[model samples]
Structure formats: structure tokens, C-alpha cells
Target: MRRRAADYRRPARRRLSCWIWGLLVIFSVAGFALFVLHHNQHQEDHVEQTALETNTKNERVVHKHLNFTEEILSVRSYARQLAEQMTLAKAYVIIAKEHNNFHLAWELSSKIRSCQSLLSKAAKKNEPVSLDDAGPIIRSLSSLIFKAQDAYYDIATTMITMKSHIQALEKLANVATVQSTVFGQLAAESVPKNLQCIYIKLTAIWLEKNSLRELADERRNSLQLVDNNLYHFCLFSDNLLAVSVVVNSTVSNADHPKQLVFHIVTNGVKYGAMQAWFLGNDFKGATLEVQNIEDFSWLNASYSPVLKQINDEDLQRSYFERTKDMSLEPKLRNPKYVSLLNHLRFYIPEIYPLLEKVVFLDDDVVVQKDLTPLFSLDLHGNVNGAVETCLESFHRFYKYLNFSNPIISTKFDPQACGWAFGLNVFDLIAWRKENVTALYHYWQEQNADGSLWKLGTLPPGFLAFYGLTEPLDRRWHVLGLGYDLNIDNHLIETAAVIHFNGNMKPWLKLGIGRLVCSTSNSHYPEKLSTTLPQIINGSMVIDAKGPRRSLKVRRKMSSLKYAIKGNQFKIRHDIVVSIQRKSKREM
Candidate 1:
């Protein structure tokens, strides 16, 4: 009975205790969480609000950034309108006076007065008002108005009055804009509106341009990125397949078993050379040739680092044998480039003389691979000349010149001209002969006249003269100028000859070396740095001895013929010839 009585209050007390403790813990946790969340939210809201306010202020300032341009344009328009109104008012007054309607004349005079007042007010208000400080314009306008008024009032009932009015206007104003001259300047055309239309057009054009750029950016950032990421995930890298250089070659002499080929390129201005070098590694049997002493000088001076190989007698023999029967006597006998012609012309009379085909290279490219297959590919005699650019449609050139086939019977008209690039395989023997010598002379004259045909212009002329219509594959020789790796997707995919066409050569002294660079890096001494392309950076060097020799050769008959001008080396063959002749005569 006693235990039962005690249990009744104990159970109730236990239940109450459990309930209170549970409630207390719940409330404590909830309060802590609420305090933290409230503080964090408040901080975040304040930061967000401050950011938004700052962004809004910046946007407002940026929006008003164009105010200067807008004001200038506005002032011009307003001033022009006022001028037109003043002119119309004067015309109306003149008509009224001619009609002898005093009422109409008086009415129009009032309008004229009103317009003048409006102009004066506008000019004045624009001065100190809101946008611009046109104080000078206001003063000029006031003075011009006075002068114009004298002219305007001088129009009396007779012709004499009109003449006097015109004279008065002439004496008062120089540009007919004496009124409100301080308002906006159109006199010196120094005003933004007059001189900077290009800037306005630029803004408008770039808006459209930027639209395209924006679209491109979006695609690049979104779709292109996704595609690239997906592609990278799927595959490793091996995008490049291969590269090659093709050199067209001729059969060696009947007695010689080897065939000879040449690589033509641009050097010191190796803008073309560097690209050709790196990319041309794919070509096989392609070798660079500097040829005679003068060419070697340019190769040494301009591209000093170019390593000279020991003479390959066997290679020379093969080249000689291949060119033996080739018909190029005319080019040799009457060369347009006298120095180059003379050096090769001495043996024009020799029958079965070796006339190897060598590529004249400008040091401005890089080779990626060996390039033998391309040069050696048998075109099945499709070439009109040694090298043919059948990809060019003669119509594109002729149509622009308005040279219809019907007009000029001559098929060789420049208007009808085809490709004129430098990568060519011509019959040197035939060129040496007088038959084709006149063509080189003509080209020389054309160049002297200032219209220097680019690398692509010569082959067409040569073939046209020879009446060669050769249709070949288009990938043999490719243009190498301005190959932007970012924009042109196809640049890395193919391999052919890339011509570096620009004012600056990649290997030249001032060149950035990205477009093209030199191949003679290890061959040239540091002191010989100012060779070829660097010639422009240094003073002229006319050694007229041996081209910057590492070791001086004794005064042999050919010793004094290094073509150095003053501080730079001479690469032109003509310079070498003069030295050689002088040295030989002295000996």
C-alpha cells in the first residue's frame, strides 16, 4: 500500500522532467541556428546591395562616356539647321521685295528677325548652358551675324545693290561660316565630325563586326569548348599525320646516273623561309642551293647562320648531267638579272652543258619534314612551264582589268595573266639561250617601272610566252603569307610550299621572327649577326673581299671579292661581279 502511493507522483514527475528537458534542448539549438543564419544573411544582403549599387553607378558613367561625341554631332546639326533657316529667311525676304508686297516683306522680315534671334539665343545658350563650352563660337557667330546682316540688307531694289551685298559677304567671311564660328569648327576640318568620320564608321561597323565576334566568342566558349573537351576525353593527340616537300627534277647527263633537284626559297627576309623550313621537313630530296659567290654572299650576309655544306662533286655532276641537254641558252646569254645571268652564261656555248634545276630560296621559312616526293612527282607532262599554277583562273585577273579575250588578241596580256609565284621548275638551259632572254628583260623592265610582280606573277608570264596550258593538282605549291594559326583551321592540316609574302622578312633584323626565321643559326658566328636581314639594322659593309670569312683566304684572284658595302654584306650578284672583275684585272 505504501509503495503504490509513492509511485503515482514519481511517474508524473518523470514525464514532466523528460518533456521540459527535450523542449529546452530544442529551443537552444533552434536559437543558435537562427542567430547564425540571420547574421550571415544580413551580411550577404549588404554585400549584394553594395555591389549592385556600384554596378549601377558604373553603368551610368559609362553610358555618358560618349557625350563628347554626341555633343559635337548635335552642335554640328543644330548649327547647320540654323544656317539653313537663316538662308531661307533671306531668300523669302528677297522674293517678297521682288514682288513689291510690303505687307509680305514686313511679315517675312519679322520671321527673319525671329530666326536671327533664335540663332543668337541658341548660340548663347550652348555656350554656358549644358553640354559644351562654345564661347568662341558665340563670339564668332555674333561678328559673322553683323557682317551677314550688312550683306543681307544691302540687297536693294536694283542689281547694283545685290552686287554690293555679295561683295560685303565676301569681305566679311572667308568660309561662309563667320556666324557662330565659335560654336563648332568646320573651317580647319579639325572638328571631330569632319575629320573623324572613320571613327564613327568604325564604331558602327564594329558593332556589326562585334556582333559576329560575340557570336563567335559564344560558340567558342560554349559549343567549341564542349566539343574540344569531349574530343580530348575520347582521344589522345596525334592530329598531325605527316609533312613532305616535293622537288621537280630533271634527268642527269647521259653519262651521270644521279638526278639533281633544287629548293627555291626566300632568306634574309626569311618570313617565307622559316615557315618553309618548319613545314617543309616533310619534303624529300629537297636541298637548298645558294649557287654562285654572289648568291652565297647574300646567303652568308643576310642569312649568316646558314651552314655551307662541303661541295658534293657527285651531286654537282648529277646536276650538270641533267641540265646538259636542256635548252636554256637564251636566258644565260641575255640574262635580265645580269649578275645571275652572267655567272651561269659563261658556258652557254658548250654543247650538252650541265643546266641543273636549282630552287632559288629566300631565307624565310621552316621545314617540318623531308620534301622529296612532292618535288619528284611526275605530273604526266601537265606543266606548261617547268612549274605550273593551274589553280589560278586567268579570268579573275583579266576580268578586273576589263581585258576581254576579244579585245587583246595576245593571250599573254597581264589582264589574262595567270599565276606568277617563285616556286618554279623551268628549263635553265632554254632560259640561258636568247630565245627566252627577252622575257626576263621584259620582267626586269616591268619591275623597274614599280609594279614588281609578286612570287605568283612570274610563272604565268613564262608559261604564257611558251603557250603552256598545264592543269595540275592544286596542292603542289601553296601561298605561305599571313598564315594565322588561330583563325585558319586548315593551316596545320596540309603541307606544300608556303610563300612568306610581306614587307618584312622573318629573318630580317627588325623582324619578330614569328612569320619566318633563319635556318643558318648554328653556321653563322655571332659577329656575323648583322648579315642578310640584319643588314638594314647595321651600317652597310662592302668587304668586296670574301664574304665574312671565319679565316681570311690569301689574296688569290678570287680573294678580294667579298661583297661587303660598308658595314653590311652585299648579297646581290652584281656587286660580286664588279669586285671579281676589278680583282682579276689588278692580278
Candidate 2:
């Protein structure tokens, strides 16, 4: 009885002990896993809350980070480094060449070429080329060329840093006695001249034509615009061809051209040409009134404070001087600074006293779609209907204004956004009520000392119409045609109006065959119609040397010259016709 009792007790005790141990192990493992899960969940929740709190603050950081000062400095530093590398490589090539070391010279030359390509890409394409990759710095000329008063200012800044390196390399090459022939060759070959020359020629032809009175007399009173329409479109341009393109495009595309009335305000020099062009060209039924700004004797340099400041040679020189760092492009510095016609739009309400509302268009723009909708837009009592530049991520007030000045920085928000001047729907009544003219004059006088903002009338316009501007749809006006060659084809097709806002005008010789056709998918008037009868097939490059050999010679002169690649089409008035004949089988 004793033995049986001991055996049962021992077995039961062992079983109980084993069961307890197993239960303890299970609890310990489960507790550790649960703790880990809780900790992870807490970390995720904390992270989410932190992100939510910091989102707007992070945006501010991004804004400050994208400032112009930092951007320009980065560009300067990167450009300097690249220039130095290029100079050094070129120097090495010269040394190798002097030594008759062909292999070494070739290797160094290849490296130099590669460096030049990267440098050119930075300057031309605005592409970020990595110097050492803290990040890639973009030294873009688009803003300078298209928007800024002094297009060469940024170029001048980069050039200041590049001069020492260029000099050092030249010294090395001089010592080797081989010369920096590559740079010299590149200097001659790199600049694309045909398009530029063509542009200059076309403008020169328009400006220098002698028979102004005869041209004016020919079309004196055939069909003058009444200026009594419910809706009017105003244009200010010096180019005759550009005006024709704009009016043609508008009338052709409009749902009712007869309802539209166009008021063209041009300089005295171009008025005759404009009148002659309009008189000869068929406008379907749209009425066009041509007004010579000079005819309004009251509107002189003294009359308009903006014109007074704009014409100041000393003030203009302060903004546009030929520095060692500035671009040597003759068109940028030498051309009349901010043409008088560009400033004429500021006097719209005064110029057209009777009109309640009018749509103002720059000559560089072409209307592809009907604009009757623009006339119907409410505008909510705002004076202006314009495309807001801030909608574009890259475009901001900082792009145009010098925010370093306290007057500008405090008065205007750097990130407040800006509007395009190319295409605008202005409420003349509202403008008069607000005395926008007086405000514009006030801003112009304030900026006389260059204290407020630098060149261009748009800055003053921005000040005048700040609160009164109503942002229109981006589709109404598509810009950057002159700056961006690879502008989206889809954007061009969908846009109601396309604006060529830079130096590369579509009427230029280079532009005649390519840019206009590429952007519009329509034949340019120069190539198709009787725009330039003297210049055959848009081939002759109007060079300083006077009369080139042939189109073949011009084509051979530079491979970079955009060749007429696509099939030519005939554009009669607004209609674009395919010149290619149908196959006999189809007929």
C-alpha cells in the first residue's frame, strides 16, 4: 500500500511540473511578440503624425531651397569647374600635339569635346549636367532670353568665372605654340546663324522698306474697321507678317469672324506696312482698324513716364552692358531695348475710350481655336483675364523680379504668381474705374531708378493689375514657343493660342521652314504664300557679308541649320492645303 502511493504521487508531480514549464514558455514567447507588435504600431502612428504636421513646413523649406540666389550660385560654381576642366583638357591636347604624340592628343581632344558638349548642354538645353554630383546644376538661358530685361546677365555672371580658366588655357596653348585652334574652330562653327540671320533680315526688310506713303495710299479707305463692335481684339506689333498671321489665324478659326473687330496699334514706321498687308490680305468679314501710335501726338516720351524711363540710355546701359561675362549676341545688347510697341498696350483704355472690353494679343501669338468663349467669360468684375504663370511649376514671380530689393520683396509676394502678357482679355471699363493707367504710370516712375524692378512693361502691369486680374485657363494661351523647340506637340494642338515669346520668331528664315510648321502643323506664310516674294523658297541667309552663294552653300555652311525635312504645304489665308498630288490609282 505504501509503495503504490509513492509511485502515483511521483508520476503526478512530474506531469504537473512539465505542464507548468510548458505553459510558462508559451506565455513568455507570446508576451515578447505582442510587445514588438505594439512598439511597431506606435512607431508607424508617430511617423504618420509627424509627416502630417511637417507637410506645409516642408513646402516652405522647398520654396526657400529653390531660391534664385542659390540656383545662380550653383550654376556659377558648376560652370566654372566645367570651364576649368575643358581648358585643362584643351591645354593637354595642345601639349600632346606639340610633342607629336598623336594618340595622347586625340584622347585629350576627345575629352575636351565631351566637356564642351556637357557645357553647351548646360547653357543651351538647361539640362542639369553633374560636375561632381552634390546635384546637377542647370545654367539655363531660357529665362534670360525670354523673360528678363538683360538676357545676357546670367551669361555674364558665368563668363566672369570662366575668363581666368580660358586665359590660363590660352597661355598654355601659346606656350606650346599650337594655338587653341579647337576653341577657335568651335567659336566659328557652334553659333547657329541661319535662323538668326533670317530673323534679322525679315525684320530689317519690314523696317527699311522706303515706300511707306505709297503703301499707305494703296489701301487708304477700302475697308477700315469701325471699332464699334460689342467685342474687340487689340494688337500691338511692329512686324507686318506677324500681324497678318495673327489676324488670319483668328478670323479663320473664329466661330464668327464677322462679329470680331480688331484694333491694331503699331508704330508709325510699321503702320503703313501693316495697313498694306491687311488691305491686300482677305480677312473674310472681320473689321481691322490700324492706328499709328505716333499719330497720337499726346502719347510721347514725356507723356508716358514709362516711355521716358524706357528711353533713358544711361538707365538702359545699367541693365544692358557689354561685360566680359555677357553673351556677345548682337541682337541682345545692340537692339533697341524693349521696343516702343511692346509698351503701347499699357495705354489700352486711353487708346480705346469707347470699348467696354477688348482682348489684347501680342503679334508673336497665333490663334488656333475659336475665341468667342473668351468674350463670354464672366471675369467676375476683374479687369484682366490672363494665364497665370504660377500654374507652371518652374515659373514664379522670382523668375522676373529682383527679390533682393526690400521694396519688391515686401510689396509683392515672390511666390504670389505672375500672368502672361501675350494674350489678355481686358475690361476697359473696369480698368478706367480702377485708374489702372495712373497706377501703371506711378509704378513706371518708381522703377525709373531701377529700384523696383528691371526692364519690361509686364512688371509694371503686374503692379497695376495685381488684385484685379482674373486667371484664365492655360488652354487659352500656350507660351515658350521661342525658348523650347521640343514643346509638346499635343500642347500646341490643344492650345487656343500659341505664343512665340522669345528671340526665335516663327517668321525668321530659320523659323519659316521649321518652327512654325513644327508647332502649328500649318505652313508659314513665308514658305507658302506671298509673304517674302523676293527671298526664294526661304533659303537666302541675310548675312553681313552680303548675298550668300546658294541654299546648298548655306546648308553646307552649318549642319546645325534645321533642314526643311517635312513635306511642304500651301497655306491660303487660314486654310492649310497638302501640295502633294494624289496618286493616279486613287484618282
Candidate 3:
């Protein structure tokens, strides 16, 4: 039994041992599999962590770029606003000086300083502004701030000088009851004797001309017809000869010459002369009506604020005396106030209320091509369509404006383009809606206390039309033809309108002669030299021993005859060709 029990126990034990071995193998396999699984899970977890870290770094870089872009945009907007404010502040400074308001100027200066400080602080942030990105703007604003400060100091100085002058005048008033008449006489004697003679002669001529004023009203009622098909041209001129040229040019260049109607406005003295010239000339296709400036009901000294501002005795005296400082041609100077005819264009809106649009031409301009195309041009809702002048070598805005005043420098771009006023297309409806006339009045009032501009109606036009100007084709208006001796003949030929902007008019003695810059041998007529003023008489006769160059010859030649004599060039018919020889000293 023990042996049998032992065998049974042994088999059971064997079975149990086998079961235990199998269980152990299963446990080992399970353990290995679990270990492999755990290793794979750990690798995945490490990859996910790495990916998260990379994503976070990328996001930070993207945020930085976005922040930088936003900051740059903010800086640009701030800079533009600051520039505008600076310009206004500069104007206020001038105003303060004019009104003797030092407190306002001081307050403005302090505000400007504060703005500078804040702007500097905002610009100096680390990692906030990129030097490469914002460097240009930052530098410009910084420079502008410095310039504005300097302008403030200049204003202060001007104010001080003005105050001194006022005090001196007050002292003089107290000191001179007895000596006043003698002092006045002495001052009168200080004027150049030649200048005094010329002034007196000119005044006499004007007085004599005025004595012959015609009571006959111009034939304006006949010209204004119900038909809307006629092409209208408006002009304000005192020169009958110039008017004849303009009318002839216009009539010849038009496709429908008979359909043209010229609305001519002149002073009381010139109305009769203008009508006589027009009638005698016989423009077969064109019709013109001459009206005196006094005929315009809305036009008076009280109508425009600009007129009121400049109508003062002191202002008129200053303007008349400004010729010396302005370096104007002595012959062009007038002892009286600036011509009221110059200010007439400002009333274009009221002058032609029934007309929708019109092109305003300066008397100095000569029309070349057909101007009917001007009527067809799209103004893009602008009140004025004109050629930009800033592209020219000399006719920049800075050439016209006083940039030393912060107001001028800050408010306007020194490089901001300016337009020529000689040929302008005005949209009357747009002008009325924009209230441009009112804007013109406001600026004129600002300039009332102190002279804001040096000369001309164009500056006021620039301010009034500011953003409302549309840039026309440059070929439409070619400028500086009178003063720019070096202008290309091809440009003149191609231009729609040729403008003689300076003192040397084509009608002047030397004007047409100087058109051609180079010549070999030019013969000038002796009579042409006589046409020149006394001031220029001696200079016109060239020294033949040195070089046979320019001799003021005033002989009338119907056609130019060119003949070459060896190295010498001869121009027949009194056409004076002045050649400027290169000096040996210069070489």
C-alpha cells in the first residue's frame, strides 16, 4: 500500500511540478511582454514631451513677430499725428508773436517739449522696436523735433524784434511833433531819383488812361445765350495785346471755333480797349464779351476775408515795399497795393454760378493744344485739376513756403508736391460743396495779423485746395518757359500750354531772342536795343573787341535769316543772340 501510495503521490507531484513549470513560463513571458510594452509607452511619452516643447518655442517666436509688426504700425500712425500737431503748433507760435501773446507761445513750447519726451521714451524700448524696421521713422521724428525747437526760438526772436520796433515807433511819435514834416520829406528824398521818375511817369500814364474811362457798358447781355452748346473761356487781363493772342490761340486750336465764347474780365480802364482790340482783330469763329471787375456784384472789398485782410493801409504799404525784399523786377514794381484783379479768381465760384466747370488760365500762359479735352477729363471728385510742380528742379513747395516756421514744416511735407496755377480746371459744384472758398477765407484771416505768404494767390489756393487737388498730366502744362532759358524746345512743342511764369515775358525785348541758347554768329538790330529799359540799356550792347556776342538790336524782322561767316554767326532782322563765353579764369 505504501509503495502504491508513493507512486500515486509521485505522479501527483509530477503533475503539480509540470503545472508549476507551465505557470512559471507563462509568468516569465507575461513579464517580458509587459516590460517591452512599458518601454514603448515610455518612448512615446518622451516624443510627446519634446513635441510640446518645440511647439511652445515656435509660438513664442511667432508672437514676437506679430508684436513687432503691431508696434511699427502704431509708431507710424503716431508719427503722422505728431507731424500734423507740430505744424499746427508752429502756426500758433506765429499767431502768438503777431498778437503779442507770449503766454500762448510758452504753453505751446512746453507742450511740444512734453511730446518730444514721450515720443523718445516710447521709441527707446528694448525688444519693442526693431532698429532696422523703425530706424528711419525714429530718426526723422527726432530731427523734426529738434528743428521745431529751433523754429520756436526763431519765433521768440522775431517777436522780440517786433516789440522793439513797436516801442521805437512809440518813442518816435512822442519825440517828433515839430520835426515830423521834415523827417517825412527827408525819407521821401531817400528814394532813388530814377525810381521816383519812373513811378511818377507810370502814375501819370495810369491817371491819363483812367481819365478816358468809357460810360458804355460791355456787350455782355448779348453773349449770354440760352444755348448750352458753346465752349466758354474766362480771362482777367489788362493787356489787350495779350488777350488778342489768347483769343487767337484758343480759336485756332479749337475743333469748333465758332462755338467758343470768351468771358473776359478787366479793370474799368481796359474794358474799352479790350473790346476795340477784339472787334478790330475779327476772330471769325469766336465771340467775346468784355466786362469790368466792378460789374461783378458779389466782388467787393468786403466780399472776401482775404480782401479785407490785405485792404489795410499798413498791409498795402508793406506789400508795395516788399518788392525790394522779394527781388522783383524794378519795372514790375507798383507803389500802390497789389492788383485787385489778382484776387478776382478767388470768386470763380460766385462769378459763374450757372456754369458747372471752367478752366482758369493765367494771362502769362499761351495755349498750344485744344483745351476742349479739359472739359472731358475726370476730376475724380476733386475741385481743381492741375499739374504737379514739385518734380521740377526749382519749383518745389519749399521754394514757395517759409519752412522755418514749425507750422509750415510740421503741417506740410517739404517734399510734398505743389501744383502750377497757370492752368487749372475747377469744378464749381465740388468747390461749393467742399466749402473751399470758406477755407480760403479762414487761412487768409490767419495771415491777416502777420503776412503768412510772401506773394501771389497761388499759395492761398494751395492751402484751400490741400487734399482736394487732382494731379493732371505734366504735358498739359509746361512751366518756367520764361525764366528757364535751358528748357527743351521739344518739351515746349509737346506741351498743351506753355507758361511764362517769370518777369521775362515773350513780349519783352529780350524774351523771344533768348529762346535759342546757342548760335555761331548772331546779328542784333540796333532798334531792338532801344526797346530795353534804361537799367538794361548799357548791358545790351556787347563788347565786339572781346567777343561779338549779344547786342540789343530792336529792328523788326518778319522772318529769321541765318548766315554763317567763318566761326562767326549772323542773325538778320535784329534778332540778338547773346553768347556767354567761357572765361579763361574758370578753365
Residues 498-554, candidate 2: write the lDDT tens digits: 888765565554443344543235433323234332223443342223243344444
Among the numbered candidates, top lDDT falls to 2
Better of 1 and 2 by TM-score: 2
Check candidate 2 and list the clashing pairs: 156-325, 156-326
Q: Alpha carbon lDDT of residue 502, candidate 2?
A: 63
- When sorted by lDDT, best at the front, the candidate numbers are 2, 3, 1
- Using TM-score as the measure, the top candidate is 2
Question: How large an RMSD does model 2 have?
Answer: 20.4
**Segments of candidate 2 deviating more than 4 angstroms:** 1-229, 315-336, 510-514, 518-587
At residue 221, give the lDDT of candidate 2.
48
Ranking by TM-score: 2, 3, 1
Deviation of model 1 at 269, angstroms: 18
Q: Could you list the CA RMSD of all candidates, in the order they appear?
A: 31.9, 20.4, 24.8
Quote each prediction's TM-score.
Answer: 0.30, 0.56, 0.50
